[model samples]
Structures are given as structure tokens and as C-alpha cells.
Target: MFFSSDHPKHEFEESQQCKSRDAICYLCKNKVSLVEDESNAFYCCQGCGSNFHKDCLTVTYPKCHEHTLTFIRRKIPFPCDVCGQEFPDEMYGCLQCDFFVNRHCIYLPRVIKITRHSHRLSHVLRISDGDNVCGICRSLVDVGYGGYSCIDKTCNYVAHFHCIIRFNVWDGKDVEGEEVAASEADDVAPLLLVEDIDGESTWRHFSHDHDLLRVVEEQESEELCQACILPTYKTGKFLRCKECDFALHETCACLPRKMAHGLHVHPVTLHVETGDGFFICSVCNQYSCGLMSYKCNQKDCGFKMDVRCASFVEPFNHTALPHDPFYLGVDFNEYIYRCYGCRQRSRFTARCVQGSIDFDFKCLNLPGLIKYKCDDHPLTLYYDHRGHNSGWCEICEEIIEKGRIIYTCRHCFTTLHVDCILGKYPYLKCGHKIKVNGFEVEIASNNGASRPICQTCHRICQDKHVFNGKDQVCFCSVECIPSQACS
Candidate 1:
């Protein structure tokens, strides 16, 4: 009695009226049998001059076509027109048009913008026959199915429907009708070239106040770059400030003034404010002095990251985890995920593409060999301590857990916890004055006659360094630095 058994109607006159009309059901593509007298079930849209089943109005997908698609509950194998894949399940379809869409493809947005590309991509039903490569995964795209393609005719960029929608790549925003906002030139470029002499360039980077000269020759001095806190001379090429001792590695100097990262959906700006004091990176969760950081200025969203963690891009490869190239996993700041390297929870991690392995930012960038005061020889970062259960950390005196990443001196047989060796604020230089929450604070050594009680937490300052405020209040770690004015 109903238009279709799947679509049940309450009144008999409505079903009779549909049977009487010659107009086809725009949704299921079924013609009304011209025999009945009464009519009330059909819903006519005056604007579009289209007739629809009463139930079909809700399931209408304008992206597919102007006509509605009827919901069907059959398990027959059918190739979905959107994804071009055969699924044995219930779906929405037009029987006459031979068009079907699975549940997953039914709700896909018409347009999306991803961090992988500059242009907004439009969902297309098919690509002109050719061998197309996905820009994100570096794999061949099947042209037979629907996918996302660059809207600009001049650009030939195309990507698989699945590859572009990964959480790491896309922010899941539908920008179908939105106009692209043009950005200022200064926002993307990092430096301005002042002059060039004998293939060397003099430039003024946005992060610094003075002009910098590019130096190519390797030097022996151990001056740390103001940007990354790494040795400037060891990096081979660097930009040295002419007016001051400030220096930056060439790569660090050229970081974008503003950029979008996978960790955050919003754009972040690079800041080189030394007065901001130490900030724990949102991605790596490591304490770093705010000498250079990418900070999100969104109100109430205090997202900040160090340059080292900000520099990581997709398809990340590491020497330690050489089995497969990794992709940015979920930004674990709001969730908990474990890292394989240190066996500790991390705020963010890079997941192996082929397997279930993840590495946090700190463990991902650990130095293989480092000098420790207890051992004359350089301590080596050991992956597994299965063979030797060398009791406790030499510094913290805590039981060294099995399978944890530790620095060990093979000769001296001394094992130390990674945190115990690097301390909490490894990137923050000692003897430097910085402003923490508008309070002038000095990074000072804690190895005095007795450790001072932290003003904020009232705990003994146990770390290698203590932050002394202008009021002579002591704080244990950067985490204890109060965001408000001291009493």
C-alpha cells in the first residue's frame, strides 16, 4: 500500500494518490501506476517542481543530484558510485540511475582544505583517464573512483579520497562555499636578503632584531644558537648577528614566520621572545625556553611548541625507527598515547605507517652520545636493557626499569634515567635572566648548601636548576612557574 515497503505511510488516500499520479518518484525512480483516484502522500516542492516521497526529503543529498535518494535496507553487493567500491550492506540509491552510495561515502563533504596542499580541493566523481599519483601518500590514485582534485584548472594535483581524510592530514572542515582569504606576504617568508657577497648572503630574519651574515665555514667555538639552543658551529652553516652574540642555524633561521601544523587546526606564528620564559611544548611536552617558539594566539588556547618539534613534517623518517616512514599521529595533547621509545605517555607522537609503533618528540630527537659528569666517557643511549639489569639511576637513585631508554657508560657501567641526566629544562640555558609571567626570573644552579623550597608548590627544588624571581622566590621547574603575580 505504501510507495515502497521500506517507506511506510499512515494514510490510505496518500498511497492511493501516488498510485494515481503519472509522475515518477524522484528519489527511488519509480513511476506511479495510473489507476487510483485519491491522492495525499506525494510531497511536491514548488521551488524545484519536483515530487518526493514523504520520507525521502530527509535523506536528500544535493551534492549527488537535485533529486532525492531513497534509503534501502538490502544487503546485495553493489558498487558505490561515490567511492567506486563494492560493499555488501544497506545504502542510499537511485535504481533508475544505477547510482548507489555506501553509508561512509554518503556524508563526505563537497569541498575540503588540507595542510598538505595550498589550494582547496573539490570532491570529484571521476578523474580523466590517466596515471595519477597521490601527493600525500606517494601512491597511485585509482582514477575509476571519486577523489579530491585541485579546483584550479592550472593545477593537476589529485589525491585519493581516503588518503586526504586522515586525521593527521586534514582538519575535517568543510569549506564548500567559503572564499579563500589571501594572506600577507610577510607572514610566509622568514627573512629579507640585505646583500650578497661572494655567494654569501647578508639577511635580516624576522625572529631577530639585527642583521645577520651567513657563515659557511665550520668553526670550533661552542656558541649555542639563540633559536634552537644547539651548537651553531656544529651545524656547518649558520647566520651570526653582527651586533650581538645571537646566532641561528641556517635551517632554524629560515623557519616560516607563520604556518599551519598537524598538531593544531589553527595557524601559528613564530615568536622569539626571551621574556616569555620557559614553555612546555604542546607536542613534545619538553620544557624549552621561549627563545623561539610557534605560539597560537587564539584566546584561552595556550598552544606552544619549540622549533625542533615544529620542524617535523609528514612522512617522517628516523634512523632509530628505520623500519617504516611515520606519519603524524593524533595530537595527544587532549588524549593519552604511549611512545615506544621511552615507554612513557606523550602529548603527541609519530605513528609508523606500516605497524603499530609510535615515538614521542623527546625520544625521537635524543642525542645518541652525550657527555655526563659522572662518567669520563660519553654515555650511549641504549635501546634495551634486557641483558643487564644494572640496578639504579646514578643520579636519582631510582630503580632503573627494565626496557626503559637509558644512558649507559659501557666502560664505567653507570646507567642513568633520561630525565635525571637531562634535567627538566635541558633547552633552557643557566645564568640567563628571563621574564616568567611578567616576573623577572633568573635561571640559577640548585647545587647549593640546601635546596630552596619552591614558592609555588612548596616542594624542595630538586632539579639541577632553580628559577629565582626578582622577589627572591624560588621555583623548582618551569611547570611550577606561576602564571599570576607573586604575593
Candidate 2:
């Protein structure tokens, strides 16, 4: 019953006697948005008037025995019902039966769909007969509590509860709430505007300083397109710099001028030249790939984006994550928030609030195998080590903080500093000479100067990586090789 009148015994626990208008959540214990909202604050047993966040009701076991299981807020170690192992933190317990469940073990779905397999999987009681490796995390699945297993016994697919709902696999849907739009508007803005909509074909791109001339006839060349870094198509209508050899596929030239990605509240504006040769994309953690990108224009904010990330308008979809659709938002929540993907603080993140989940752009942009030259095989982010960011970087040899996300390869025992492996200026083949405008430049290491800066971004490079060109030391990458004529 919602109120005390339904239960004849008017008995109430101390917590239930008075509902504070500033009632804190019994589970997360954090101040909820309900502190001020007029809508239903949380789940309350009318008899006691005790309040609870609705999330605490459904994400948790709905019922224990015949009654609703109460959430234990205090941190106490107790044995679990499913695995009989030590359960920590918020546990679901039954006062009458003396039963308790690990917070993670409750609300375990019976059957579910995951991107790992084509078929639906059911919760298996145990996998005792043979070797059982979780299909998602690729670790040994603990049979004590069982796990979501493939329906077909011949196909051996088992995954831990936490491994199944990775941002990459499940669609971020709030299973409890009614289906609704994630944003106020669903329509997408026009990507780019043509110079002459009357079909003149010449285009003025937002990122480029020069107007791109369209190729009308077959004029094939061995030159590669500047945007995709691929060979120019011989038969396709592409755009080329009127003077320089820089070119782009027709489709690549029309990227959106501005977009609201799921990571930040401000719109990311497209830029042809990031103006920083040494700046790495925080999302992909790679060099700018000599392509147009979107950047957060807010002062003191360093957020930048690749063409791929800028294209995914709000309500960005993955192979689809089944909790809540992540959207672009700023963290004004009045509390610290750590990202679920990179396991870093939400300094710059894409998020789904239903689970209080935040993902780094690297995860939200694409949530699957990451290809890096440092490792032979693809490296993937593991949720097991998500919150434990303790280690030392192999490249820079700096101590990685306990809360930083360190991507690892279980097979080769290869753990890497995300930045070192996917660095922006680290890919240059040192000593290689290239021409920019009219001047020749050579790739050189930063000689540890007291004050060195990139000519483009004007940010102090601190003698990091540099391009020696006629007295001007360019610390940015060759993508924007600095030159007097080009200046």
C-alpha cells in the first residue's frame, strides 16, 4: 500500500515517520533532483512515510520472498543468497527471512539480447560441466551466481551481469520509465551549406580558408585526399584546392558546420584547421588525421572532435547501450562524477543519466575493439578494472592515478597509457623533411627549451615535439606545418 492506512498496524520505523522535503535517496544517498521538484520524490511506504528514489525500487530486486526488499544503506559485509559470497555496500535484504543479495546480483534479467551473440540468452544457474569464459569480458564467469548464458547449449556463450550492459552492447534505455524522446527536438540541422545551391557545384567549406573547386571531368591523380587520408577516387566528383594538391571526396566535404554531441553541452563548431599540430583528439586519442573537426569554443575548454564524432547528433546511438540514451550535457549536478567508459572524472564526457552513467568520448564515439599500433591485437576497455586506475605508464614512466582508466591486453600482459599509445604528435617519423607553402621543414624532437610554443595554437609546447623551419619552431604536427608565406 502507498500509505499507512492499508497496514492495520500503524507501526513506523524512525526513518519512515517523517519525510523530509530535502529527503536524500536511501540507496545512492546523494541529493536527488527531487529535493525541489513537485513530482513524486521517491517510493514511500505510506504507513512509515519513508522516502526512496524510484530507481532504487526497479533497478533493485522488486520483491524478496512475499514483501518488498528494503535497501540497506550502510556499508556492511554480508553473505549473499545466490553465491553465498561477501556482498558489499547497498544490499537488498528481507527483514523477516534474514535473506540478503549482493546489490549487483539483484534485478538480474532472466533473458536478454547482447551484441556478442545473434540469439537471445537466458540466465543460467551454473556452468559447472566444462570451461566457461564470459563471451563479453572474456574472463572466467563465476558459476556461483550463474550468468546470462546462450539458450543453445551447443553454442557456449556466458557473460557476467556487469559485462552484459557495457555501453557498447546494450541500448541505453531506462527500462522502468515510459518510452520518450531523449531531447526536446528530434529533427537534425542541415550539415553544410553549398556556395551555390543553384547547382554551381563550387563549395565554400567552413574549415577551409580557400574555396574548393569541383572536379567535373575525369582528371585522375595518385594524390591522396586530405580529409580521409585515402587515394582520391578517379571517377568520383571530388573537391580540390585550386592551387595546392589537398583534396577531399565530394561526400567528405559536406560535414556539419556545428553539432551537439552527446559529450558536451555546448555545440561543437567545425574547424578545417585545429591550429594545433600537437593537440590530440581527446575522443579517439589520435592525431587530427589531417581532417576537418568540431571543437568546443568555450574559453579555457580544450574539447575537440573528429568528423565521425561530430556527425552523431544528439541521442547518439551505438550497436545500441539498453539503459538510457546518452546525450550531450554539462555537469552542474553539484557532485563529482566519474566516467564509466574511461573511468576518469567527467571533465569532458558523454552521458546517460538513468544509471548515473558517464562515458568518455572515446567510448561513446565507438564502443568496440580499438586498433593501436602498440599492440598486435585490438585492445578493449574492461569494466572489471574500470574503477581501479592504479598503475605506472610505460612510455612516460609516470605513475597513473588510482582513478584513471588504463586500457590493457590480458593475453600479452600489455597495459598502456592511453595517451602515449594514441598520441597526437608521436606518430611523426622524426627527421623527415616536408615542404609547406614555399619553405622546407624538418621533424625534430623538442630540445627542452624554457619556453617553446606552437606558432598556430600559440600554446606553450614546453619544448615537447617540434618542427624546425627557418627559425620558427613549430611544436604542432605537420598537418599545419608553419611557414612565412603560409602565415
Candidate 3:
């Protein structure tokens, strides 16, 4: 219900001039009662015979307009002018103007903060023309409809009205009138520049204790990056610690201290601490040892995502699979499907909406090219062994399945299993210490005089790596890490 404010005094004067019986209320499009007293009706315009029920003229939506907006009844469904969503229910609008709003969207938050972006989004009647992709769902956002867009004009971020309001996306707060909090001082830099002598900059990364020297030269060494646990051979530029053996890929070193991910509603902070041992990423379900993770900020939530999974964004286009660009489904967790890449059933996957193809994160993020021990040249990842007969893996000595992803050398045509090349814990670096089932375990090389016997699998550790405990108990892979502590 709206009270007549001083601002609409001219409208009230117009209502008083056209006090006529048997006239239609322009606000509600309903007949003014002839039996009712003159005080019950209000005239809208003198000569137009446009009158309004005093009850209809009393209600106003201040956010949408200054004039009175009243309930409108319609038998057919109509698209809301604000959200552009079609609905069959009655709506509220100003009869004089074409502005009609859904009842549910009447009090939409003017300003909101979502987990997938850094900037606050503002509710607007219309975004720009052309293809407007939603930042969350990676679907087309209608430019004619109302949606949330970045407050910064320079940033072209936009989200659908339905996608932005989901429980997993929005925090459900309207911060329009509240005081904006100051930017976090710690978020300014991923690494602090300590000294710049003769164009060589020594920096202190937040993940490391000592100062680091940027090495632009590509390294051929097999040493793994402490941040991502990936070998250094392929990493072009990296930052090596001046004091100790800690090092990080230049890309990994520049990761922001805090970010919002689509996996959870709250912002996640970068965690470099290695005390918790191996953490299984909630998204990829892969074990990561000595690699940094992005953990949810909520106190009770146990959401932790690996760096690889955290880096993935909507509408991902793999260079190898360019024709099938995949986008994360908004309700991916609610359903499971067989993956096209690995044939494993998983809910955490991105889909090629056009092709109806799903690829799990594990198979989706496989390195395109990697060096194998037996092959002199780098092996290229193959989605399917097309144009070639299915062969056995040279490393695993197992028949390479037709549908499964594999790595093959074009020069030698040597085929290898994806797991045989990447191993069970591909992200886990050799020689790093991790905790498993309350036991301190070390990732050890399995290339000894005799392969170690895996305690969990009761077989010889066939993989290139093994997890060893202080008691000499061995595990072939991260999946074989015993639930009970080693005696």
C-alpha cells in the first residue's frame, strides 16, 4: 500500500478533477463503483474521464516509479518488462506506461555480490546488445531482459536474473544502502616485490617464506613446481626461492590470494600449507600433495579445490577439442552422466551443450603434450584412436581400450595408457610428505632394485611412484592409501 507523498501532488490534483461516476480506473482498468461515495474514487484526468479507485491510487512501487502502480489482471501470460521472464500470474504496473513488473521481482536487490566475480553487480533493466554470456552458467543472457552486470563499465561481466539468484551463487544480501567495506589490504599482491637491482626483481611470494628470483629461462630439469606439483620441464618461466628448494611456475606464483569460484557460494582463499597431507579436490576428486588449494571461506564447509580445477572457467575451450567447447552446467551436481573422454560416470563435469557431450574434469584437463621415458619425442593426447587400430600400451603392457583417452607419439606411433603416463597421483610430487589416515607418508620413487610390495593392494607397486610410511609399508597409488594408520 502506498501513501500519497508530496512528490506526486500534481497526480493527486489530476485525480481530484475527473471525479466522474461509471468511469474506468486507469490505474487498475476496473470500473469505478457508482454506488460508492465520491471519496472512494479518485479522478485521474479531467477531460479524458480517466479515473482511479482511491484504493488503486494508494499503492505505489517507489523503486520502479514515482506514480501509483496498482495490481493488473490479465488472463494470458505476459513477459515481465523488467526480467523478461514470461509468467501467467497477475502483475503490478502503471497503466499509463508500458512498465510492468513481476510481483517476485519487485524487490530485487539493487546491488549484489556473487561468488564467481570480484566486483559487485547492479540490477539493470537491460544489458548491451549482441551475445551476452552469463559469467556463471556460460549461457546466453538476453540483452532485452533485466539482469545483473558489473558496476565497473570497463568490465563486461553479466549474469542471468535466475542464475545470479541461485542459493549456490548468491549470498542473498542487498548491500545497496549499506556502507561498502574497504578493499582487503592483503589482496593487493600475490607476490611482493622486495628488491629491484639492475632490472632483476627479487620478490616475496605469500606461499613461500624466503625471497624468490624470477628465472625467465625454460628449465629442462624434472623438478616439480611446489605450488602445482607439475614438472618444470614444460613450465616456461618460474620463480625459484633464493634460500631453499621451493619453486613455483610463474603462472602459479601470480594466483590471487582470494577469489570467488562457482563451486561454492562463499569466497575461497588460497591455502599453501602442506600440513594437512593429501587433500582430495572436491571438484576433480583427485589427490593433490604439496600443491596449493583454494578452500571455501565458510567455517563449517569442507570444500577444497585444486589449482587446476580452480583455474577452470565457464565456456572452456580446449585447443585439442575446439569444436566441442564445454560449459559448466548450473545444476551439474544434481545429475551424473557417462563421460565422453574417460567413460566414467561423474556429476562434476562440463558439457558441450551443442553436441550433448560431457567430459569429467580429470580427463578434460589432461596435458596435450608430455614426454614419455621410452619415446624420444613428446606424446600427444588422443581423445580417440581414430584412423589407427587399438594397440597395447608400451608402458603398462595392457591393451589400450578403444574409447578411453590415450597418449601416442606420432613419430614412433607408440601408444600408452592415460594412467600409465600420468600415474594415479599425477598432481602429487615425488619426495613430498603427505598425511594419510593419521600416518605421515612420503611419496617415494618405485624404481628400486625390486619393486616395493603394496600393503593395501597386496601386489607389487607397478606405478613409477609409491607412497611409503615410516614402517616401510608401501602403497601403489593415492587410491590405495589405507584407511587405517600403518603399524
Candidate 4:
């Protein structure tokens, strides 16, 4: 199957490579089945003597230079010239020059369609100009190199190569020759882009009476998203009730309605609001407010799922490692065990417990890279904290626990405790600015300098939580807002 005009005027030959149990494909960077699957045949290029899958032989792509890259076994680790991503597996490369490319880089669709945006996104080779931020990961993208961008020039939407294809946003279909379904359930009515009487895009959510208007611009007053409990920053688009002040980010609005949820036997219905007062989530054991949550409708099922739990894409695959998928398992006061991730012994934590294995949501959701205003360079998450002198945390000054996963700045030798950086309650994102008290107050660390006291309540801002935005900033909890404080 390996054929190329560029290889030789006199046809170059390929000899059949033996059927092995496992062989890595140079193009896709995935191990191919050799024994079980009869189609796992490979051929060696007489021109190159490099082993290649029959499937990978044909993905010959031409790079910026005139070099034509063909699939071949990688003797040395190579970085793709197109995407700048490194790969250890065999890849399409010119045997002569330094030019190399992965299958994804070679055949990456020129245009893609995703659920997050309405317009078709084209694979841009370069940013051309301006700060084009990725809509999904919230990180700055490389403008020098190209990425997925909205087809519409006026639109500012852009996405990094990996961020756009995350399990949260994409359903893993390439935009080539396939019609991308809006969602897994297209039969259900689409609640996202509906319009109200004012000609603004509005949504009729199962929760509220009035249609929720999509607010693009930040209002003079600050608004907290009912779902995530974070301020509706002007930068992010949010849906607000035209009748009332209820608002939530678009990501929260698109949360699925029904899930087996793995933790509960009965299917949980996404409840907009419960007439019942002050329901605590069965898994995280946190109190819920007015935001929509996945609540068990079954009799005596007191299980409630908060928006963060509900928003996690189901069948939580652990592709980062070769392990069984983690289901959202709940203890329900049954099992009290130490978490393998934090090594903390707690009666209960926000954990994803599999049989004989336990990992807290903080461990699962911990970003690979952490940014601290306290330090210049971002700290990378290090799993093995052994042999290093139990360094003191820069924030709390507590000894960094040994054998626990911690964030560390290798350059400066600074280490941080898991909770000191993430928080005791990691689900509630701390330190991000949201509106409180008419000033932009930081969600300072509980262990950091001085904790802010609520001007009205006179109690310390417990957990060192802070939310700030346009009009107001709050040091204490959302309950300690103008409604309670002003009263």
C-alpha cells in the first residue's frame, strides 16, 4: 500500500513485515493490534527499511518546505514541524532532512465544527495579529503558530489544538466527510440559541419562568453565576433571566439533563430548583443554593449533584494513564478511607472512588500547570515528592508533606501543599476575582497574609474564599452578600 511518486522513478518495493502482538504506528501514534486483528499487517520500505503500518503508508504529507514526509518507524524522538508537539512514536518524516509530522498534523481538518460555537472553525496557519485567546482552556494561545479559529473574520473565537478537542467540548469526530451532531441527543430541544421578544438570544430553561437572555457585555452591576458560584466576568458570555437577575455561564447552561451518574442506582434528573430547603450534595457533601443541580427524583434518594459534578463529562476516562475509567462513586457514610492522591485521612472528601482505589476530584481536576501571582514562573504538578528536603510551603509555611502530589517550581525550589494551593474545598474555585463590596477583592489564601473580614457580619472569611467583579467584591461566602450584609 505504500506508494509515492516522489520516492523513485524506478518503483521502490515493500516487503511484508511480520505480524507481531503490538507495534506502534508512526502516523497515528497509537499501538496497532498485530496478532488478534488479521488486518494488522505491516510492510518495510526497501527505500528506507523502516517498518510502517499498511494503513500509515499512505498518509504522505508535504510540509512548508518541498520535503514529502512518509510514515516510518522512529529510531529517535522527533517533534512535528507543523504543530510543534513532540512524539516518541514513529511519525511521517523525511528520511533525509529534519522535517517530521504526525498523522494529526498531516491530516488535521482544514475546518472543524464544534458544539461550543455556531460558526465553522478553520485551522489557521498563523494568528496574523492580535491576542486570540482559546475559548475552552482559558489559556493564551501561540499566535505565531496557527490554530482553530472561527471562519468569520470579525469573530474573535480561537482554540488551541488540544483544548478544542477536550472531552468536555468535542465528541471526538474529525470534521472530514462526517456530519457532526449538535449533541449526543439531537432529539431533545436545543435550549442554547433561542430568541426572546427583544430579538436577543434567550433560553427557556427548565428552572425559571422568564426566558434567560444572553448577556455579552458586563453590566454596571456584578452578577454571580448561579451554577458555578463565580462572578459572570464580562469576558465570558452568560445567560441571565430577562425577568430576574439569575445568570450563569454558557458552559453551565449546556449541562445534560439526565445521567445514571454511576453513584446512584436511579437516574438523576437535572433539577432546576428544589422546593425543599438546603439540600446537601450526596457526593461532595456541600450545601446547594438556587443553581440547577442533578437531583435524584426517586423516593428516599436524598442524593443531590452540584453543577460541577454534573458538568464533568461522563465515563470519566483516565487516558493520562493506562487504567480503568473512574466512575463517580459515593460513600454515603459507608466507607471512610485515606485518599491515594492527597494521602489525607478524611471521613469524606470530593472523591472519585473505584474499587480498592480512591482519588479526590482535586487530584483529578488538578491542572497540569498552576499559575501563582506570588511566583513569576508557573509551577508544574510533581507526583513524587520523595528525597527532597521537606520544603516549607511559600504560602502557609507548613512542611510540604512527603509522598503526596505537590506543585513545585523546580527553578526556585518552591513547593506548595495541595490544599494550600488548590484549597480544602477545591470545587469552589478560589482566588479568582468576582464582584464583592464594590471593590475587586482577591480570594486570598486562608494561610496567606491577612484574611479579610466581612464588613457587616464581623466574622472571618472562612476558607479564605474571595469573589470579585465589576460592581462588588465579597470576602466571605456568597450568603454574605448585599442581601444578608445590607440587611
Best of the candidates, lDDT: 3
lDDT of 4 by residue, 28-107 (tens): 55775555344766554555544555666654444333565665444466556655566655456676776666656666
355-467, model 1: which lDDT tens digit per residue? 66778888866766677876788788775523346578989888987666778888988989888887767787777776666666789888799989999899898888899
Please state the error at residue 216 of candidate 3 in Å. Answer: 4.2
Global CA lDDT of candidate 4, please? 0.57
Q: Which stretches of candidate 3 lie over 4 Å from their true place?
A: 1-77, 89-104, 128-130, 179-186, 216-219, 313-319, 322-338, 345-358, 384-392, 397-403, 448-451, 478-486
lDDT of 2: 0.55
Model 2: what TM-score? Answer: 0.36
**Reference-based lDDT, residue 101, model 1:** 77
* lDDT for residue 195 in candidate 4, whole number 0-100: 57
Listed per model in order, the count of residue pairs whose N, CA or C atoms clash below 3 Å is 2, 21, 2, 14
Q: What clash pairs does model 1 have?
A: 14-41, 17-39
**Segments in model 4 whose C-alpha atoms lie over 4 Å from true places:** 1-192, 196-200, 209-224, 230-245, 274-279, 287-290, 314-333, 344-357, 365-371, 376-382, 385-390, 408-414, 422-462, 465-487
Error of 1 at 164 (Å): 5.6
Please list the C-alpha lDDT of all candidates, in the order they appear. Answer: 0.71, 0.55, 0.73, 0.57
Error of 3 at 220 (Å): 2.9
Q: Any idea what lDDT model 1 has?
A: 0.71
TM-score between model 1 and native: 0.73
- Single out the weakest 10-residue window by summed lDDT for candidate 1: 4-13
